[model samples]
Every structure is written in C-alpha cells, then in structure tokens.
Target chain A: MLFHVLLLITFIIVILIYEWKHYQGRDRYVFVMLFALASIYLLAAIVDWRIPEYVQGVDFLLSPLKKPLQAWLDQFQI
Target chain B: MEQKISSIQFTVLVFMNTLGTAIIFIPTIATRYGRENGWITVIFATLLGMVFILWLTTLIGQEDDTNFFKIMDNRVGKLISYCLILLMVSFIFFTTFANIWSIAQFVSLQILMGTPPQVLALISTFTGLIAVRYGLEVIVRSAEIFFPFTMLSLTLLALLVWPEAQLIRVQPVMQLNQAATFVGVLPVIALTYMELIVMLVVLPHVNDLRQAKKAFLIGGGLAGFCIIIVTFAAIAVLGVDGTVRHAYSIYVLGQNIQIAEFFERIEVLVAFIWFITIFFKVSTCFYFLSIALQHMLKVKNYHSLTVPLGMILLATAMTNLPNIFYDFEMMNSTYLILSYITGLTVATVLSLAMLIRKYKEKVK
Candidate 1:
C-alpha cells in the first residue's frame, strides 16, 4: 500500500511539473494526469479493504438488473 | 492534426486490436452450430472484414486526404451527419466500456480473484486516457514495442501446449452442418471486422493505403492462424466438453502443462500479455474517440476532451453491466452480432451513401 501511495505521489508531482510546463503550450499535461490517476487508482486497488462489502453492494445493485435482462432475451436463446 | 501512420505500424495496431479475447470465445460460438466448422466460421468472417478493407479503403481513398468526419460532412448532410457522428462516438464509447470492464472481470477471475472489477477498469481507463493524450503517433510506436513480446509469449504457449494435443479431438470433422457454417460465422463477421469501419477515420492517413490493406489482411491471417492452432490445441488436450467449460482455455492449457515441471501455473505471464493487448485496444478506441470528439465539437485541441470522454465511457461501463456474466453474454451474443452486422453492413451503407455524395461533389 505504501508503495502504491509513493508511486501515486511521484506521479502527481510529475503531473504538476508537466502542467506547469504546459505554459509552453504542449499537451503533455493530459498524459501527466492520466498517469497520476492511474497511480492513485492502483494504490486504492492495492489497499482495498471492503471487498466483502463491495461484493454485496455489487450483488444488490446488479441482481435486479441482470435477471430481467436475461429473461427479456429468452426468446432469442441460441 | 497528426501525421499519417506507416503501413507497418497500422499492421501491428490492427493485429493487436483484432487478436484479443476472440480466441477464447471461438469454441463457444462454434458449438452453437458445429465444432468442425469453427475454423470455417473464422475464415468466412475474416473474409467479410477483408472485403470491407478493400471497399472502405477505396471509398475513403476517393476523398484523398479526407478523414471520417470530413467525409461525413459531404456524404451525409449536416444534421443527419452530426447525429451519425454522435452515434459513432457513442459506439466507440460503449464498445470501449465493455472491453475495459471485461479486462477487469478477467483479471479478477483469472489472475486476481476478488480484485474489484472497478479497480482494473479504473487503472485501464487511466492508462488508456494517457495513451489517448499522446495521440496515435505514440500509440503506433508502443504497439511496435509490445508486438514482439505478445508474439513471443503466444508462440511459447502454443509450443508448450503441443505435447498434450490429441489428434482425436479434431476428429469427426464433418460433425457441423455445412449449411449452418456460414450463418455460424455471423458473430465474428459482425463483431471483429465490422469494427474496422471505425478505421474509416484512420484510413486516408495510412501511408500507402494498399499496404495498409495488405497489413490488415496479414494481421487478420495471423489472428486466424493463432485461433485455429489454439483451438486445435484446446480440442487436442481438453476435447469439446473441457474446452467449452474452460473460460481461459489457453491460460488453462498453459497452467496444465509441465514444461519440464518448471512452467506450471504460468498463466499470470499470459495475463500480463493480455494486459498489453487491452492497453493497445483501449488506447486505440480512446484515441479515435478523442479525434472524433474534436471533429464533432470543432475543438482545436483534442486533449481537452479526453477526461470528460473517458468519464463518459467509464459511466457507460459502470451503468447496467451488473456483473461479469452479463458482460460475457453481451460480448458473446449481442456485441459480436452488433459489430458484425450492424457495425459492418448497416453502418457501411449509411457511411457509403455519404461517401457516394462526397464522390459526386468531388467529381462536379
């Protein structure tokens, strides 16, 4: 988790520098934020603590959606 | 605003784009009709893409220096053209969403069980957004770098799986009905190749469009070869029941192999290889989406639209997907048909009507 956080910090700093350099009028800032977001997300994923909770949440959200949609397509069964 | 990609780069890009996730689904798709004709379905479907390559490239070539949006302006009138352009953007958005989230499902299931699908989707979207920011030039270059490694890993796996391959698995070759084979190929035809229509934007910019066409054919051939060999290997080892049940049959095959007892459970290496494919795939879609957004919105810089567009795709993936099983059902049943039929023929005629008008305008 610390490694992910450190990587995220490093990427955020890099993005800040790249954005500052955006004064020169290149599009480097887009890529910079991209990496930064990627790093933060990776960090969160590594540190994900609520898997059981998230799993249940997903089931709650999806069950209503999945079953009927499947039923709607029963006629098209192949 | 960017320069055209060379034929070789386009070659690798198309290959990386076409080769993903198609391998695993072949048996599933084929089983619906017949097993013997699985390879035949790939052939027929690939031929449809190949034909589209000829006609779509030629149609765009007539507009010399034209891209999809410009062609749309001439081919279709402004209002309808704008609507179609929006549809194209949404199409790319939805397809990218499915692909992005599926990668998550795969990682969670095959590599890191219980890893949140959102985690993979988020990482992949961010990585894709970065690639989108770089534009096509960097994407083409990165594809070159990853191309060799993807080939090497796939080859090594195919080689390893050869030992356990049973010749009997492919026997009873005529088990599938000849009449149903052509119909069986529809999903592949529609999904894999129909998406090539999206390449209409990238077509005119290809250096030596003929060579680009050739590269498309070659890349497709390479994919088909990989499909046949891998399918054959799967059948040889797992037979129909085992192959059908196995989600990551190739990865399963990889794990099942001994390779001097040192190479057991090496599917993670392959999971990484697929990571590379997903990288190129998402980037390609994101890049195209950016360009299309620029054209549609008349933005001077595509980079500005990248974040919002990525957000939209993320939303599309998040909305209504519900779970991995639905995602697979969508990909296998709905998406393939949509991409093949709706993507190829329906979209083609719509665009072609626009192309014809453009050609007449140029002629006049």
Candidate 2:
C-alpha cells in the first residue's frame, strides 16, 4: 500500500517535471488529462475501490447473444 | 528526424508480439477444444492469419511512409478515421493492460508467491514505460537482441523434450470433431494474429515497405510454427488431458523435461522465454498506446505521456483482472469477440472503404 502510494507520488512528480521541461502549448491539455486519470487511479487504489472490469461490461452487452452464438458455433460441432 | 527500424528488426518484433501471451496460454486453449487435433487447429489458424495479414498489407498499400491512421484518413475522411483510430486505441490499451496483468499474475503465482500483484504489475508497466520513453528504434532493437536467445532456448526445450514425446499420445490424429477443431481456430487466431493488428501502427516505421510486408508474414508464420510445435509436444508428451488440465501447459511440459538425469526441473529457467517475449509484448503495446494517445491529443511528444499512462495501466491491472480465472473467462469469451470486432471487422471495413474511394477516383 505504501509502495503504491509512493509510486503514485513519483508518477505525479514525473508528469510535472516532464511537462515543465518539455512545455509545448498543444500538449498542455493532454498532460492535464493524463494527470487527472493518474489521480483517479491513485484514489481508487487508496480506497481499495473495485474498478468495474471492462470485460464485464462487454460480457453484459454480449449476454443476450451468448446463447445464440454458442448455438451457432455448435452447429459446426460434429 | 524520424526514427526507423530495419525489416529484420520489424520481423523480430512481430515474432515476439505474436508469441506474447499466446506462448503461455495457447497449448491449453487449443487442446481444450480441439483435443488431440489441437495442433492442426493451430495450423488452420495460421493459414487464416496469413490471409488476414495479406489483406492488411494490401490495405497498407505501396506507401513507404504511412500509418493506419493516415490510410484511414485518406480513404474515409477525418470523422470516420478518428472514430476508427479511437477504436484501435481502445483495443491497444486493453491489450497493454492485459499483457501487464498477465505477466504480473504469472510472476506472483509461480515465482514470488508473497509479492503483491500491484508491485509486479508496476514493475511490468515501468519496464514498458522505460522502453517507450526511448522510442520505437530502441524498442525494436532490444527485441531484435532478445529474439535469438528466446528462439534458441525454445528450440533447445523442444529438442530436449522430444525424447518424452510419445507418438501414441498423438495417435488417432484428425479423428476429433472437425467442427470443434474449426471452433478452436478462432481463439488461436484472435490471440495471435488478430492481436497483431497493433503492428500496423509501427509498419510505417520500417525502412522497407515491401520487405516489411514479407517480414510481417514470416514473423507471424514463424510464431505460428512455434505454437504448433509446442501444442504438438504438449499433446505428445503430456497428452490432451494433461495439457488442458494446467493453466500454463507449456511450463508443465518444461517440468516434464528430463535430460540424462542432469537437467532436471528446469521449468524456471525455461520460463525465461516467456519473460523476454512478454516484456517485448507489453512494451510494444505500451508504445502503441503512447503513439495513439499522442495522435489523439495532438501532443508534441509521446515521451511525456508514458509515465502517467504507465501509472494508470498499473492501477488498472491491479484493480481489474482479479485473478487468472477471471482473465481466462474474459479471454475465452469477451476478449475473443472484441478481438474479431476490433481487429478483423475494422480492418476489413477500412480496406473496403479504400477500395471504393479508389474506384470513385478512377471513374472521375
């Protein structure tokens, strides 16, 4: 946990130093977005929050078709 | 000045990327559905994959210095191209996370039982981050360096394990349900070649366009051959039941290797092949994500984004993909479907669009 926190801090520092050193007008928003994503990830880790698995979402979307897909695939089963 | 890699380096990257997680997981999955006929399924998948690669190279066309994004933009216009690029980026990101999580999971379970997965995931992500920071030239060159040793080790493992291979175990060949063998090809294709659509991003970076296409085919073909050999060896040595029983069947095959009562229990040492290949896989995916993000964000340099992106990947790998079982379930189901949709479907659509545009111009 401490290691994760320290790692997150180090990442934040690196982001800041990188943006400072390679300050480009177009990349400012990109860095800001990255920083926001990093902060959210850190907060989730600290809170021990279960990030919703993207696969689950995909599974949910495909659930209705799962049986049909299986049945279709089964037709090929000799 | 733009960085470029030679065709040989590109081939090595393709080889490593195709082997990626497939090396660890292919034998089990192939044997599960195809049974003793599993190796045949892999061969079938490779043939299909070759067709897919040929199509992809055609879509990339005669351009010496263009990427998938540029091709899509030229054919389909900005809005549609952006949409497709975003989808490709999402797919690339998912793969990067998957590779990171897989290596971490393997290390935690097999080697460092006490280490937290997050730490392993961070280490994997950091390695990729460092590679990405140096750019494509370094990444491909490193892959080139590691390619020979990884292949040699794999070849040695194959040769040493040959003594244990019982032809009787692989008997009754091609007698399995033909449908099942065909069905087995989907996952193998999805995991190996379809996942390789990420390479299209780096295709423009290869110095020789024509040779790079040939390299692509050769690399993918070689990797497929490796998988086929490993799958056959597992079946011949461990039999179908034993192959499907373990999560990492190739590792189990390594465990079965005994040479002159001296080289015993060398699975850990044999695992070096996977470590090197997976590192290249993760790094390649990470590099793709950085490139995709740079294009999406109009960033001047991709270097600045790798650290934060790596952090996010670490967190995601830690938070999601709770265990190997979940990953297996995902891989067998949703990931397979997603691969087809994002990989084949998208590439086919882009290729058709390019054809229509060309036809229209010719008519004009």
Candidate 3:
C-alpha cells in the first residue's frame, strides 16, 4: 500500500518535472488528465478494490455464449 | 512520420507479434477441446486469420501512406473516427493487459517464485517502455535480430523433444468432436490470430505499401505454421490428456527434452524464447498506445506519453487481473471474440465506405 502511494507520488513528480522542462502550453492538459487517471488507478489498487468484478463486461455481456462453449467442451470426456 | 522499415522487417514483426504468449498456452487450450486433433484447430484458426490479414492489408494498402484512423477519418468523418479510435484503444489495452499479466503470472509461478506479480508486471512493462522510447523502427529491427535466435531455440527444443514424441499419442486423429473443435478455435481466433489487426497500425509504416499485402500474407502463414508445429509437438509428446491438464503445455513439453544426458532443463531456453516473443508483443502494444493516443489528442510527440502510459499498463495489469484463472476465463470465453470482431467489423465497414466514396469521387 505504501509502495503504491510512493509510486504514484514519484510518477506525478516525474510528469510535473517533465512538463516543466518541456513546457508545451496545451500539453499540460494531457498531463493533467494522465495524472488524474494514474491517481485513480493507483489509489484503487491500494484500496484492494474488486476491480475485476466491475469490469465483468466479459462475464455479463458474454454469458450467453459462455454456457454453450462450456457445454460443448464438456461433451468430450478428455 | 518517416517510414523506415522494409517489407522483410514488416514480415518479421508480424511473425513475432503473432507469436506472443499464445505460444505458451495455445497447446493446452486447444488440446482441451480438440483432444489429439488440437493442432488441426490451430491450423483452421490460422487460415481464418490469414483471410482477415489479407483483407486488412488490402484495405489499408489502397491509400498511400495511410493508416486505419486516417482512412476512417477520410470516409466516416472525425467524430466517428474518434469513436472508432477509442474502440481500437480499448482492444489494444485489453490485449497488452492479457499478455503482460500472463507473463507475470507465469514468471512468478514457474521461475521467480518469491517475486510479487505486480513487480514482475512492472518490470515487463519497463522493458517495453525502453523499446517504445527507441521508437517503432528500433523495435522492428530488434525483432529482426531476435526472431532468428528465438526460432533457433524453438527448433532445438523441438529436435530434442522429438524422440519422446510418440505418434501413438495422436492415433485417433480423424475422429474429431465437431462442436468442441469449433469452440476450441474461438480462443485461438480471438486471443491469438485476430491480433494481426495490429497490422492496420503497422502497415502504413512499411516502405512499400504494395509489399505489405504479400508481407502480411507470408508472415501470417508462417506464424500459423509455427504455431501448428508447437501444438503438434505438445500433443505428440504429452498426449491429449496430459497436455490438457497443464496450464502451459509448451513449457512442459520442453521439460521432457532430455538429450544426451546434458541438454536437460531446456525449459529455461523455452522461457527465454517466449520472453523475446512477449517483449515484442508488449512493445507493439505500447507503441500502439503511444501513437494512437498522440493521434487522438493531436499531440506533436507520442514519445512523451510512453512512460506514463507504461506506468498505467503496469498498474492495470496488477489491479485488473486477479489471477491466472481469470486470464483463462477471459480467453476461453466469447467476450474477446465479440470485442475483436466488433472492432474489425467497424474498421472494415468504415474502410469499405471510404473506398466507395473514393471511387465515386474519382468517377465524378
């Protein structure tokens, strides 16, 4: 957990320093967006969120097709 | 913007990209359904992949120095082009996640038993970041050098395992379970072969667009043939039941290679060759992430985003995938198939619309 926080802080500092050196005007917007995303993800990781369960688009969306495939594979007594 | 790769380099990149972590698990995955005839499923999937590659290369080759997004923008306008870009980005992200996460899992399980998976995932992404920093041409050139060495190791492993390969293990070859075999092809198609769509990003970078058509065909064909050989070796050496029982049957196949009482423990070499393959795979995904984001944002330099994006990939791989079972579930499910087909279909539809518009413009 502490490692995640340290990594996030280091990432933000690095990006900020990079932006300061390069200092392209609108490019800061991209950096800001990136930093925000990294924070959310890193914090989420630290929180031990059920991340995979939410992205269950794979499960919910494709559940219909899954059963048929399971049934087919089960028929072969390997 | 300066396209530097020749036809040969493009071909090698395609071969290396197609040969990703699939090489590690396709034997087990396919054998689970097709039994002794599992290799046949791989061949069928490869053939299907070839058709898609030909269609893809021809679609992009029609316009000079063009890519998938540019073509979409030309035909469908910027609004829909952005939407399609998002879809492609998601597909690429999911792909990179699957490959890197699987590598982390395998390394932690097979070799580095003490290391945390997140650290392994980060380390793998770091290697990819270095390649992405060097740019696409460097990655392609590196593949050109590494491709031969990887292939030689694979070939040596094959020869060493040949004596243990009992033909009797695959005796009931003709009688195949049609439904299971078809189901087996789904993962190979969704996870492995359909990844040739990376060509849509790469084709525009080739020096000769004309050569790209042939390059992709040959590359996809060669890659398919190589995968078939790996699958055949796995089934023959381990038998259908044995192969299906293990998660990574190819690595197990390597463990049986006890030649001259000296050339044992060749799984180390197999792992190294797969490392090269996965490195190229992750590098290609990182390159796609950088360039695609640059194009989407209309930024001057994608290189600036490479490291930051690599950081996201590492985090996502750590957080997004909980275990190897989830990875297997993703592969064996239809979710990836549906997603990949949707992206390919949209790209193809948009491209076809562009071609029609072009023809109509010319006629007018």
Candidate 4:
C-alpha cells in the first residue's frame, strides 16, 4: 500500500513539474485540482473503500429492470 | 497552422471507432440473442445505421467548419448546450473507462495471468495519454497506417477458418426466433454505430466535408461487413453453443486455426488486431473527453489536462469495475442504456435542433 501511494505521489509530482513549466494561471490550478481529486480516488480504491460499492449499488437498483427487459426481449425469440 | 486529416484518414478513424470493442464482443452477443440468425441482426443494424449516418452528415454539413459542441451552441442557447456537453463528457468518460477495464481484464485473463487489473489499467491509460498528448492528426495517421494490417489479418482469419465452417451449424436460417433476431439488432447497433457519435467531435477536422460524409458511410459499411463475417465464422466454425460459451469468442475462433498442425495456437496474433483497434477506441474516447473538458473549462491548452484526466480514468476504471462479471453485467444492462440515451438520443435531438434553425433561417 505504501509503495502504491508513493507511486501515485511521484506521478503527481512529475506531472506538476511539467505543468508548472508549460502552463500558468487557471490551467495549472485546474490541472492541480483535477489531479488531486484523481489521486484521492485512486488512494480510496487502493484502501478498499466503499467507493466501488456505490457503483455496484446502481446495478442492484437496476437489477429489477433486467429480468423484465430480458423477458420482453425473449418474446422476440421464435 | 491548423491540423487537418484527409477523408481517407477520417474513414479509417470511423472504421476503427465502429469496430472498437465490438469486434471482440459482438459475435457472442449476437449469437446469444439472435441464435443462428445473428448475421441478420448485423445486416439490419448496418442498414439502419446508414440512415443514421445520412442524417448525422446532413446535420453536420449544414454548418461551416464547426464541431458538434459549437453546432449545439449556435442552434440551442448556451445553457442547454452546456448541459448537452456535460452529458457527452460523462458518456465519453464511462466509455473510456469501460474500454480500459476491458483491455485490462483481457490481458489479465489471456496473456499475463495473476497481474493486478489496476496495473494493467495504468498501462492502457498511459498509452492513451501519450496518444492524446500528440493530438488528433497523429492519432488518425496511426489508424490509417494500421488499418490495412488489421483488415488483412481479419480476412486471413476468415479465410483460414472457412474450411472448418459447416453450413449445418447455422442451419435453420431465419426460422428460429424472428422477434429475438430483430431485438438482437439493438446491442450491435448500440455498440458500433451509436458509439460512432463520438466522431462528431473530430469531424470538423477532416479536410473536405463532402468526402468526409462519403467516407463515413463507407467506413460504417465496411465495419458492418467485417462484423457479419466474424459472426458467421464464429457460428459456422464454433457452432452457436460454442460461440456463446466463451467471453472472447473471436480469440477462440483464432485458436481454431491450424496450417498442417505446425502453425497453430496463433490466437495471440488474432488478439493483436483487437489490441490495435481497442487502443484507437480508448485514445479517441480520451481525446474527445479532453476536448470536451477544454471547451467546458475554457482552458487555453487541452494538453495540460491529459495526464490528470488519464489518471482519473485509471482510478475510475479500477474502482468501478471490480471484476469481469461485473463488467459484463454493466455492459449488457447499464452500458447499453447509457449508450442509447447519450449517443442516439443526443444525435437525434441535435439533428432536430439543426433542422429547426435552418427552417427559421429560411423564413428570415
């Protein structure tokens, strides 16, 4: 876990240096915020947070529709 | 100087986009739903898809040298255009993640066993980042160069597998399930033609509008034909049961090839075609997502965001898709619905908006 975290930080640092050299003002700030959010998300995933479960929740809610849709679609079968 | 791609290059892009991941999954989906009559679903979808392309090109041609986002801004107001743009960006984001996750799953299962999916996802996303960093012309040129080899390999796969194909496997042609066969058209259309809606983001960069439209139809037709041949080959060679059994049916079909028993197990070579096509698809989606972000944030350089966006993509793919079964479930249910809502529905609304604006202009 530490290795992964360090890897993520290193990637962000390299990208930040490149951005700092090439971009300024709003672009750099936006890129920083975006990169930070993405890094947090990756960190969350590495730690086995409930982040993925929320996505699976979508499937759980939509599961009811699948059977009916399948049945309806199966009606087209000769 | 502005970068421009030729119509031929545009056609290759379209071809690559339409084939995308559909090349890997279409045979199984078609045979599963349509049974032995899967090829019929492809043909029907292709015809409908052509009409769709016609409407799309006409809508695009009505404008000058502007992309779909700009067209939306002109026809509709800023508020609605931004909403539409957000929807497109979301669609592109999910699609890109799906592609990355797919390649990761494939590599993990087939080639590099026991490798973590996140690592595989990182590799795929990083490649996409490099491609998007270079911009569209470089991406299109790469596709143009790879198109012939991809096609040649596909043709060879079809021809080499033909001797093993039996007519009896696909026997009761069109007689089994008419309703099911017609319904099967949805997934194929959703995966191939509907997904081509992303091309609207890059259409304005083509050198000639008239030729771009022609290339659009030809590219779509060629992709449809390749899909048909593959579906037929899988069914006739593997039988309907065999085709639907494997997740990557095309790879299994490639494994069936043998030249005097010495030249066998060439599934890796067959898998290479998919790798090339899916890379273009992932890169195109990433590129579209970046452009959409640049327009939305009013950024001076889209290049600056590629690395960050690619990171987000990698993270999202790893988080959302936990396993191959989850990926399959999402593709069949959520992803299918999302493609229709974002892709076809958006295209239809934009076409209507274009017509209304044109009619209002004529009155003025």
Candidate 5:
C-alpha cells in the first residue's frame, strides 16, 4: 500500500511536470485521463476506509473474469 | 530521451525481462506432458526463436532505417498502420496487464493470502509508470545493470539446490509424453518473443542500424539459456511430479533450500529479486506503449502519455483478466499464437517486403 501510493504520487508529479513544460490542446485529453485515474485511486482509498472489510464493490466491475478464476480456485478448496 | 543502448544491453534487457516469469512456470507446465523430454522442446523453441529473430532482423535492417509501424504504414497504408498500431497497443497492453495480474496472484498465493491482489498490482503499476515516465533510457540502463545479477542469482540458487535436487525427477525423460514438453515450451516462445514486438516502438529510437538484428538474437539466446538452466534444475531437483504440482516452482525450490539450516527464509531475497525483475519487465512494456501512443495520436509531448497509458493498463489489468487460470490459459493458447506466430510471421513478411523495395530503388 505504501509502495503503491508513492508510485501514484510520482506518476501524478511527472504528468504535471510534462504539462507545465508543454501545455497544448491535444495533450489536454491525456491530462483528463490522468485526473480520472487520480480520482479512482482516491475513491478506492475512501472505500477502503468506509466499507465492510470483505465487501469490495470494485471486484464486481470485473465479475466476468472473476467467476471463472474463482471456479478454478474452488476446484482446489471447495 | 532515448539513448542508444548497445547490442549487449538490448539482449540482456530482453533476457532479464522474459526469464523471470517463465522460469517459475516452465518446469511444471512442461512436466504436464513431456516429463523429462520437456527440456528438448525448450531447446526446439529457442532455436525457432532465433529463426524468428533473424527474420525480424532482416526486416528491420532494410532501408538503413525504419520501425515496424512505419513499415506497416508504407507497405499497407495509413489506415492499416492505424490498425497495426491499435493491434500492437492491445498486444502490449493486455500482456503487460496480464503480467501484473499474475504477479499479484502469485503474491497472494505465496504470501498475504487475504489481501486482494489489487493492492500489489497498484503498487507495481505506480512503480512501472514512474519508471516509464522518465523514458526508455532509464529503464534500459537499470535493466542492463541488473541483468547479470538476475542470471547469477538464478544460477547460484540452482547450485545451492544441486546437492538435494533429485536426478530421478526428470528421469525416464518422456514418462509424461512428448505433447506436454512441446506444449510447455511453445507458449513461452510466443510470449517472450511477443516482447520483441517492443521493437516496433523502440526501434526508431535506435541510433545505429547495424546493432538491431544482432540485439534480438543475442537477447533471445541469453533468455533461452536462462530458461533452459532454470527449467532443467527444477526438474532435476524437484522432479516432474513436484514440478507439475507446484504453481511457482522456482520459488518453491527456494523454500526448501537449507544451507546448513541457517540460510533458510532467503526465499524473501528471491521474491525481492522477482519483484525487481518483474518491475523492469512491466515498466519496459509500459514505456513502449507511452512512446507508441505519442506516435499514434501525434501527441507532441510523449511524457504526457505515461500516466494515462499506465492507468488504462492497470485498470484493464484489473478487469480484462477474470481470474488467474483463465489468464494462464490465454497466455498458453491464443496470446501465445499472436506473439510467436503472428508477430514473427508479420515481422518476416514486412521486412522482406521492405528489403525488396530498397533493392529496387538502389538498382534504378
């Protein structure tokens, strides 16, 4: 977790540095995407703080992939 | 920001990048079919990999300069270039993402079983993005510095286990059947060389055209050697049954190492090395994607693409992969085909076409 946060901070800083040096219209969309990513990280952090320990809403966003993997895991333990 | 890396650095980077992930899986997967004869398939795939490299080199060598995407643009058309770019992006994107996903799963399986693999992935993504943000020069430099140690440590590990490693494990050499060894090595051949596709983005940055083809063969050979040694050791020590049963066989080998019983738990050292090598692998791919994105969208500032590409890669990694086994299966089947067959074939055809074009111009 500490490791991830530091990387994210570094990433955000790199983008800002790049934008400051070469601000242009075409690059704006990229910054927009960065901002959205930052928001997801922030939101995920918030969810970790408020939600029940086992209940993760993010995993559902990837339900299609999770089902089969879970089924494979179940083969061993279930 | 792209400094010209020598043929050695390029070769080392590829070997270090591909060897880490494959060594852990190769023995077990190979044993699933070939038993001891699995090593033979490894040799076969490696030789074939060289053939792929020679062909890829032949293509890149044409015209004194030009990269894959550019060749596609010229040979096919602008629209086709766009399609090729899109395909390349998806290839790098999914493979990079899938690697992250598996690394997380490996962590979860090995330690921190309760923690979501997502957390480990996020850590890797951020580290990878930062590495890519600085550009390929930094990534290549660090990989060069570490590549030798990566191979050395793996060799040292095998040496330590030699005393206890069972010869009978890989014995009767095809007890499992030839299909297993063939299956085991073939997929890895594809995925590792799929990484050669990194050249599509990185080649244009090469200052010397002379070193291009040499780099691929050298790298492929080194990586091939590393894979063979690790897979052979795993079979020799753990045997086919143990190899087949263990998910990350190499790491498991570390767990059993008892150098007078004092040097135990050093598997942490192995894991740390795994972390660094895999990080290098992920960052290299991430950096290339950002570079390619800049070229595709005509973005003036290539740096801006780093975070956005990183985010998409991470998010896609977390979602596009449903679970670990399915991802493994895909790497085994479809994705394998794309990297080895499609990637190698297209590189051969495109380069041949480019060479023919150059010859005609010179003759006229």
Candidate 6:
C-alpha cells in the first residue's frame, strides 16, 4: 500500500512537470485541483479507507424510498 | 470542443457506451428478480429509457448548442452550477471507478485468474486514458471501428448458442413476482439507460446537433435491444437458477458454444467484445470527467488532467468499492436510484427552469 501511494505521488509529480507550461492563466486551477485530488486518493489508498463508505450516505438516505417504490411497481406486476 | 463527431459516430459511440458492464451482469440480475419474464424488463426499460432520452434531448434542445456545464451555470447560479458539476463529476468518476473495478474483477475471474486485481485495474484505466488523451474524436472513431466487431461477435455468439437454448427454461410465462419485477426495472435502467447522461456532454461536440435525437434513439434503442437479446439468450440458455448462480451469465453463456469437435472454447472472442465495450465505456466516462473538471476549475485544457484522473481511478478502483457482494447490493438498490433519480431530477428541473424563463421573457 505504501509503495502504491509513493508510485501515485511520483506519477502526479511527473504529470505536473510535463504540463507545467500549460498551467499559465486559469489553467493553474486545474493543476491545483488535479494535484489535490490525486493526493487525496493516494492518502486514502495508503490508509486503506473504504472509500465507498463516504458515498454510502446517499445510499442510506435513498434506502427508505426503495421499499415504497418497489411496492408501487408491484401493483402492475399482475 | 474544436473537434466534432458526425451523427453516425455519435450513434455508434452511444451503442458502445450503453453496452458497458451491463451485458455481463444484467442477465443474472434481471432474471434473479424478474425470472422468466426478465426479457419483459428489457422492453419496459427501453421504452421508459426512451422517454428519458427524449426528455434529455429536449433539455439539450432548449440550450441550442451550449455544453451541459454552461447550461447549468446559466439555469442555476454559479454556486449551484458548481455543486451540480461536482455531483456530475463524482457520478462520472464513480462510474469509471466502478467499471475499472468490474472489468478487473471480470478479467481476473474469467480470463486471467493469475493476474493481480490491481494490475488489471491499471491496465484497464491505462487503455482508457490513451483514448481520452487523443480526445473524443479518437474515442468516437475507435468506436466506429469497434462497434461492428461488437455487434458481429454478439450475433455470432447468439447463433452459436441459440441451438443450446431450451425454450422450456423460460417456462411459467407471466408468473413474475410483480414487486421483484418492478424493482428489477431500476437496475436495468440504471445500468443501461442512465448512462445517456454522457450524451449531454457529447452533444455539444456533435457536428449536426439536429441529428442528436435520431442518433440517441437509434443508438440507445439498439443498445437496449442488445441487452434484451442477451437477457432472453441467458434465460433460454441458462434458465433463471443457472443464470443467477453464475457471476457472469453472459461469459458462462459464451462457454456453452460447442459447434464441431474443433469449434469449442469461443469465449476468447466474446471476451474481446466485452473488452472494447467496457474500454469505450470507461473512456467515455473519463472523457466527461476531464471535460467537467476543466469547466469547473476554469482550466484551459482538459488533457493535462487525464493522467491524474486515471491515477485516481486506478486507486479508487483498487480500494474504493467493497467486496463483490457489497458492490452488487449497491448496484441493485442505491446506485440504481442515485444514478437515475438524481440525473433525471436535475435535468428536468434545469430544462423546465429554462423553459419558464423563456416564457417570462416572452410575456415581458
């Protein structure tokens, strides 16, 4: 995991360097955003975080509606 | 956005895009709930998905040739537009992540049992990144070349496997568990149709925007039709119980081909079709992600982010999703709703809001 994290960071640095010239003007924001996103992913992977859990909140919120939705659709099943 | 694709390319790209991982899973997932009536869900989902594509095109129609992000920015304010962009970006990225994971799982399980999942995930994402790096034109053109092979392979497989199908397997005709059948509709729609959201991104890049409607219908309809055939084939060939028992019903279906004594083991050809379709799917998602991020961050070029995004996708694909069971649960339930409702609600609201604003201006 640690090796993977290092590898990801190394790739990000190479990309940053390769695209450094394009970072002029508003493109700098993309540079920053890409760097930050890649870093977060690297960090998350290293920590072995179950990243799906972060997105599962939406799943939980929508769970209550599934049954009712299913019941309603069942009416036409016959 | 300087490059543009013709309607034919757009249509073919749509077919490839919609074909994604659903081909592998829908047979089992749909039949598990809808039983012998699983094919019915395909027809229903296609019709309903047609309505959705119509509604989406109408939304795009209101904006002339403006891209989705700008349309959103204009309809809702900047902040809300940014929020929607985040939602869309996450949605597309998550999709790419999921597909990478899925293909990795599929390859490791079926094709290369000895390969590490992480290696497979990287290879899958890398192929997509290469296409994305060249821009949408490369992706669409490659789809043009790949689309025929995809369809031809599917046809050949169907022909080869048709003889093995026991029509009796699809027995007890309309005895579907209504609730399960209806609940079944969500995943099929989510898996196949909701992906039309990518159309919104690609539309502005289309050469003749007027052909968007026709392109969408033919492409989406054909893609849905393919799924229907696959579902029917799986049920007829494997039956509901057998279909549900296998992780990849389509892959298993391919394994059933026993022509002459020498014509066995044709799954390699089938795997090729799966590879290109999933590759295009991931590339399409990755394309949209880069474009959306460029717009959101006010970047000038989208290309530079491709490598970074690919890296993120690799990491996420490797570690983000839980085990196969959890992944399946999410796809059938939460993801089905989240992908469909969130997209439909947002697009409808934005379109209606745009229409209302037009009316107010006319009144004034």
How many collisions per candidate?
5, 0, 0, 4, 6, 0
Model 6, range B1-364, lDDT digits (tens) per residue?
A: 5778899999998898888888888887788778888888777888888888877777665455446788778777898778777777767776889899988888887889989877999899999999998988999999999888999998988888998999998877777465666667777888888877877888877877779678988898998898889889999998888888887888889899999767897977668888989999999999889888878766778876777788778877777676677777667666776787668767877777778888999999
TM-score on alpha carbons, each prediction: 0.78, 0.95, 0.93, 0.95, 0.81, 0.92
Q: CA shift at B301, candidate 1, in angstroms?
A: 0.8
Instruction: Write one digit per residue (lDDT tens) for candidate 3, span A1-78.
Output: 787688778867876776556637556667567767766765677667655542466467668877886666567535
> Per-model TM-score of chain A alone?
0.42, 0.64, 0.64, 0.65, 0.36, 0.63
Say which candidate scores most in lDDT.
Answer: 4
Clashing pairs in 2: none
Full candidate order by TM-score, most accurate first: 4, 2, 3, 6, 5, 1
DockQ of 4: 0.50
Candidate 4 has which clashing residue pairs, if any? A76-B179, A76-B180, A77-B180, A78-B177
In model 2, the runs with Cα more than 4 Å from the true position are A70-78
Query: Which regions of candidate 4 fall more than 4 Å away from where they truly are?
Result: A52-71, A74-78
lDDT for model 3, on a 0 to 1 scale? 0.78
lDDT value, residue B310 of candidate 5: 66
Ranking by lDDT: 4, 2, 6, 3, 5, 1
The TM-score obtained for chain B by all candidates, in the order given, is: 0.90, 0.97, 0.95, 0.97, 0.90, 0.96
- Model 3 scores a TM of 0.93
Score residue B350 of candidate 3 by CA lDDT: 68
lDDT of 2 by residue, B1-364 (tens): 5888899998999999999999889988888778888899999999999888887777677654555566667778888878888778777777889889888888888889989777788788888888988888999989988888998988987888899999998778887667788898988898999989889888888888899999999999999999999999999999989998888889888998898899988887557998899988988888888877777777878876777788788777777677887887667677777788889767888888878979999999
Looking at every candidate separately, what fraction of the true A–B Cα contacts under 8 Å does it contain?
0.03, 0.44, 0.31, 0.51, 0.17, 0.45
TM-score of the A chain in candidate 3: the value is 0.64
How big an interface RMSD has model 4?
3.1
Candidate 5 Cα deviation (angstroms), residue B307: 1.0
* Of candidates 4 and 2, the better by TM-score: 4
